[model samples]
Target chain A: MIVAKRKPFDEIMEMLEEYKKVLVVGCGTCVAVCLVGGEKEANILATELEMARKLADNPIEVDSVTLERQCDREYLAELDDKQTDYDALISMACGVGIQFLAERFPDKPVFPAVDTAGLAVNQAVGWYEERCRSCQQCVLAWTGGICPVTMCAKGLYNGPCGGTNLGNCEIDPDQPCAWYLIHERLAKQGRLHHIKQIYEAVGWRDTMPRTLIQPGYKKPEKEEAK
Target chain B: MSTDNGLKSGSNLEKILKAGHFAFTGELGPPRGTGAKEVIEKAQHLKGNVDSVNITDNQTAVVRMASWAASLLLVQEGLEPNFQMVCRDRNRLAMQADILGVYTHGVKNMLCLSGDHAKFGDHPDAKGVFDIDSMQLIAMVKQMRDEGKFLGGAEIEHPPKIFIGAASNPFAVPHEWRVHRLAKKIEAGVDFIQTQCIYNMERFRQFIKEANDMGLTEKCFILAGVTPMKSVGMAKYMKNKVPGMDVPDEIIERLQGAGKGKVAEEGIKIACEQIEEFKEMKGVAGVHLMAIEWEHKVPEIAERAGVLPRPTVE
Candidate 1:
């Protein structure tokens, strides 16, 4: 799932600079699962903002709302006319959702409260690790399920650099070398020869930012009179 | 020396290799700060003694003076510099731009390495941009030079003219596959191969033998890397700590036998012995002395190895 971290408190306050009435928006999807921008966290942020404003003697009023999934326009209709009560809105979702809110409320100032890290998996209750860079091209089949593009320090599709010591990466002793794992997995399968398979220089053209269209979906502009 | 004779001159390092000279190249770790004083001074000790000095790009992922700039600085001192480029930092566009930039500055030799990760360095939070790995990097640079076009097929006037190099670590995992990997790098247009630091003499000898059997030596100049252990602690650290580096126990034993204060001298003696072995090792073209943070000792090491009186291309 997409993982995001809260923007530093100072930065969040800075984003609401000069705003008395603010809306703290949250997402019920990925950001919520990561515990950064869910409804509970949104209330905590709103309370904190209220306390900070009261302490500053500015006494700003705040409203909190969490959408089912902020990326889709339909879920956002839950706000209806109530969103205009605030001078600005701070999105607690990922970058995609922030852009969605901005586009939906073109006139309202929308600030991003979270920085979208990468696609990550939950490692522990409070810990998450990024696993995919979404490079669009996957080579896991050749690498024994290891993602060299995301794991290797140099993202070397070939193998570990001369720097790998033991099983850990030369860069970080705590991190296991991605190539080492690939070698181990391939060796266990008696497919050591697979490790020798050299991948040519990756043609990056296919991995460039691209859009996927749903099949058989006829756009209104392309649809005939029917 | 029948092995030595007049040969074609390309880059200074290439000229030395072509002359059948036992070439020695030193590593110049760029300084973290802007002042080039320390780097230039360190390089001064290497000027007359080594064939070509290598300037590292942010070795260990620590920010340092740009390797290209350092290489240019060494050029000003009448010394040849092998500018090293790492893949962990830039994309193809920046890489191609820097290639042209380095060539314009008269830096000739290039060492293409997949740089260490940023997580190891001071800035663990910095984003890594490994747009291309070392092999692809080698092919791309070759593309620029031979085809006069970018990796993306865009034509550029006046391609970078320089010798290309890549690294090999026989001690890396799947150690048996290292030599075959060298073959792949050669196929990618590498002109020279600098293997990881040598300590496991037996393994390196085997690696060289296999490389020879594969006829890799004829395809590219292979320089075996040797780092002089500064102390018993260093020997132990590299042997046990550094990844892919195997400092045999016997060498550490020799260092320990050096008693207390003489370990440094013993390390140099060991390095000299390695150079002597490299001179006779089949398929080994030269010795790349990696006196990391110990550039001052390069001259003495080269002199002790009897590779002094560096061949003059002119």
Candidate 2:
């Protein structure tokens, strides 16, 4: 899931200070599962903003709403009527959701309330760890299901560098060395031959603002003229 | 075995090792600034005492003068530099360009390494660019040197003729796999391997034996790495803080038992003993003396280790 964390309270306050009235928006999907930008968080933020503004002798009115998923246009249609009276919109969703909100309400200023971390799995109620970089190429089958691209600090393609000590990374003792884990897993499965093969340099497709057209979504070819 | 007549790169280090002489190499870290004074001064200490000097590439990830440029400085001083390149700061294009650039400047030997992570460096926020690991870098250089072609399969007008070297760590975890890793590096076309510092002789002996059993010793030159412990504190720091460093407690206790002012002498004595052992150990071709920041002590250590009067090979 896409994990995100709320931006610092001071930065969010500064962004909304110029507007007298604002609407706080939240998403109900990934951010909600991560416990950052759900309906409950939006309500808490709205109440805090009102109290903080009142104490500063700049009383302002704030309203908040939680949509099913801000990335989909159908769910975003719910904000058409409620967004007209606000001076600006504050999005507590991930970066993608915030951008979608801005694109829909082009006239109103949209400010992000949370910083999108990365693609991760929820470890516990409040903890999460990154699992994949979505580098557009996956090599899990050869590496015993361990993603070296995300797990290794250096993202090494071959075996471990010279810094693996006692199965831990040189950067941090608590972080287990990814190659060490891969080696043990492969050795246990009797697939040690997989790591022995030399892997070529990774062909990174990290061009910014990448767009992926799923197989069925790609445009159909033009019909041949008879 | 390769001989001087069939030298691959004609580097002084390669020639010495090829001539069946016990090779001696030292390491020199470039200064943090752009000045050449430190490089030149350090080069003077290793001039005739060692076969070749390794110019480190931002050792420990700290920013410094570029390794290739520092190596050129050594070349200008009539010294051969085993220029070190790391995959931490540049992509493949930059790496290949630097290899070609350094070769034109008279640098002959090259060492490929996956550098220390930038998080441990002076600029912790710097982005690390590990476009290729050390293994692939070795194969790429070999292809460029032996086949006269670039990694993209484009023919080069004049490809770099480099005697490639790579680092090995026998003390890293999954201990039994270390020898197999050496075999993979050998298969990748590395001509020589310099291991991590050795304080645990028993473990190192086992590693060398395994390498020999697997015929890795006959394929490539294995140089044992040794660093003199300056004091008891340094030993403790290496054992506790440094990764892939296996400093046995006995060595630390030995340094402490040296009494107040004799610890430095004791450290050098211990290094000399290890070098002496490496001289007799089978499959060991040389000793890479890394007196970090203590380059002046290299000549003295080399002298006592009986690797001097350095060999002169054609």
Candidate 3:
């Protein structure tokens, strides 16, 4: 899942203070699964915000709405009728959802209510940790199920860092060194012998810049020439 | 020396919730088997930490001690229990009677839910009685409070006053369904809402804004629920084993980033940080802490977050 954490409430309130009537939009897909943009959370937040606004004596008018998926144009269209009622749009979706709302509602200001973290999976009931970087590449096959890029503190591709001691990473003595874990796993599979293979020392892409596509996909157009 | 003390005042929890910027709550899963002692012990430990204890009725499809029984125990022990009554376990008749039973015992808080499927619990063969969903239950309670009559049309001798509440899991699929449920619950006369544990504060902030825009925020008190994971492995289990919960990846990364024994400390620290963040933000009333098995860590978390005891409510 595209994991994103909700921004702190005070920051949100500060951003929202400019408007009298604020519309909070929640996205159901990615943010929903992560409990970021889901409907229930949206309502809870709306209730708290309204209460805070009232308590503050500002008495702002707030509206809560959740779209099936904020990334889609069709879902964004659903808000077309109600879009004008609010002075601002506070989106609960990931970065993509916020921008989509912004693009769809050019007249209104779209603010991101959540900060998009990297991709993650639920580790357990109340636990979720990062497992992937969405690096636009797949390398899990070569390194067992563990991803060295995300798990390793140093992000070293080859093997254990020199600091690894007693199966724990030197950076945080209490934490299992990611390399130690990788080494342990490889050893268990009798693949520790593979660790000695001379790896081609290749550099990863030098610069990693974040990018977002507006309305992400497009169909191929017809050829101009006959 | 302060460890393993007997029951404290219910105000401990109240104070904690009010002290924080936002509040959180979660169900106290009954013991794995039928034993009042285990459940009672958990409640006692959780008592002063959480705003209110939600004694769950057959959580995760598992059959265990009855919620009413457990809630009654909590109240008798001077603790506030948010009795989670699911329609899946009882018919309306039993439910009505149980509601009366609990209220008389001074257990006023409740979270209406449709119990999990029998197959989902420990006993798959168990029969499920979803006589009502959360909305219907809320509606029934509201009618009892407002009209002074039960679903059976019998006049209540003296209508009970309860802090009516309901549950909402925004992480459930068909995301719009979560909103629809909230609207329905509010319409049914819910006074407050205690949501599924949330990890993503940004989403929660947006959630608040949306609810405000929809005018739903005006209707009730919203308490954000939080559960501090004991370990990274435990976090993984919550993600894999527990249904209806959503833990964001950033939190996991941070936890996974923490080394072994440090993860627990880090989890508590994260919770404290979230609590602090919630307190500073607008549109939040209180936080309900659900420390789960780490109930003892609650006081430390609260204290660290600067949510110390108030001078005592009059």
Candidate 4:
């Protein structure tokens, strides 16, 4: 659930203008869920590119394909056979998928059509709001399910700030203060008293992140020795 | 005093609306199978009978023939194609980009909707991305037109004059909420509304009356949607499986009573009856024939309903 806002049309057109035959690829994963990267979107983009190009007398040829999961090696194999058809590729996947495609097809130029934002939860149907920062730690058990990282404009760890006005954030009058929501949530759970307990300062460092890392298996002695 | 006269000429949508009454419009669902030839053939069949043929992005959320390819084919064949743009699959950037692209290709009409979920269709594993609803997309388009700049502040030499159309499901779950949703679209400045498939004429007339009473009927052009139920199975599916659709028991029972060979004919007859009735109803601007898989029968349905007159030229 990556919360991403779409890029403007003119920017995309300028990118496509540089390529004559463009292969628009869509990823069927987080980007697809956010509606930025999907087969349908890729095709729509391809169509728009074709239309825009035709008007400019360039008449670009667009061939679109949607991979099941652009980040996976097996799913990315689908693009290997069709790589020769286009001069460049416009991927509708997230940063990861675009990188994977670039890694797989180093010979051809690959571009991203969507800018991947942070993880989001659907506030309602068709509305996605940023929720989590994936801080590599689970503190929700202590925070009572309210995320201060996303809710707070400053991502503050403790207490109200000068921006907190009458229980509402000064940044947005309509939004409830994150601290207020946290207080309410903790109060409902009868854990409001725990709010006073000083927790260790959080360190924001992610040296490496793996989406599908396996654990508990030791490699062969020869492989491990290397 | 002269500076106060900032009012301009009617928008492109106004030009299209003033172009004629009983303006015929039909939808083209991208094929699920490997047969775009069938889609092209059907578009050719609907060419003269309808004012514009709508190419759906992905109806029911199943992967299929691309709307842009199908629409490009239609335009190549010299037919006015209305491209159905959905926010279910793209964010605002992609949506705006695609709209501008289609406009450059001579696509005139656009029916915006928050498309169906993947769970409802064949691909259960598919992810549904609803970046923006129909209204937001409409506002984006209006912004592109009036301001001559995109949300990203990119300048445009000339913006497209696309007729902005939105969807309405008066028969949606919890009927009372439908009016509120329709009001949302109206407030968003949608030029026209094409409702979800209507089966009960009584229910449709009531919807029209209420809309007029709310002063919405006059603000936007209302096009009643009609889909011919193929058989008893389809009738049942439309009643139960189909989202945002209402199929009366009488129509279902009629289809159930009819045998295999006559079921399609009966369904077409009922749909035609609905259209004929819609033609006489006041405040009803036009009809959007969503023939679904049975798109070839659109000309027949239009002719049967007496809406066919070669779609009088403007």
User: Best lDDT goes to which candidate?
Assistant: 2
lDDT of each: 0.85, 0.92, 0.70, 0.73
Q: Of the pair 3 and 4, which is ahead by TM-score?
A: 4
Top-DockQ candidate index = 2
**Per-residue lDDT of A1-226 in model 1, one digit per residue for the tens?**
9999999988988778699999999999999999999999999999999999888787888889999999987888777697889999999999999998888888999999999998999998778998887777798888888898788777788877777777888777888889889888987887867656667667664555566668987545634422
DockQ of each: 0.50, 0.79, 0.01, 0.02
Q: Give the TM-score of candidate 1.
A: 0.86
| Per-residue lDDT over B99-184 for candidate 3, one digit per residue giving the tens place of the 0 to 100 score | 88888888767778765556555777765554454566777877776677987778998776556777765554434334544665
Q: Which candidate, 1 or 3, would have the higher DockQ against the true structure?
A: 1
TM-score for chain B in model 2: 0.98
Instruction: Tell me the lDDT of model 3 at A126.
Output: 42
Model 1 reaches an interface RMSD of 1.9
lDDT of 2 by residue, A1-226 (tens): 9999999999988998889999999899999999999999999999999999999888889999999999988899999998999999999899999999999899999999999999998788899999899998998999999999999999998869988878998889899999999999999999988888888877789857787778777744656210
Query: What fraction of the real A-B contacts shows up in model 2?
Result: 0.86
* Model 4 DockQ vs. reference: 0.02
Candidate 1: which pairs clash? A164-B243, A164-B244, A165-B243, A165-B244
For candidate 3, the per-residue lDDT at A156 reads 48
Judging by TM-score, tell me the better candidate of 2 and 3. Answer: 2
Worst 10 residues of 2 chain B by lDDT: B1-10
TM-score list, all predictions: 0.86, 0.96, 0.53, 0.57
Instruction: Give the DockQ-based CAPRI class for model 1.
Output: medium
The CAPRI-style docking tier of model 3 reads incorrect
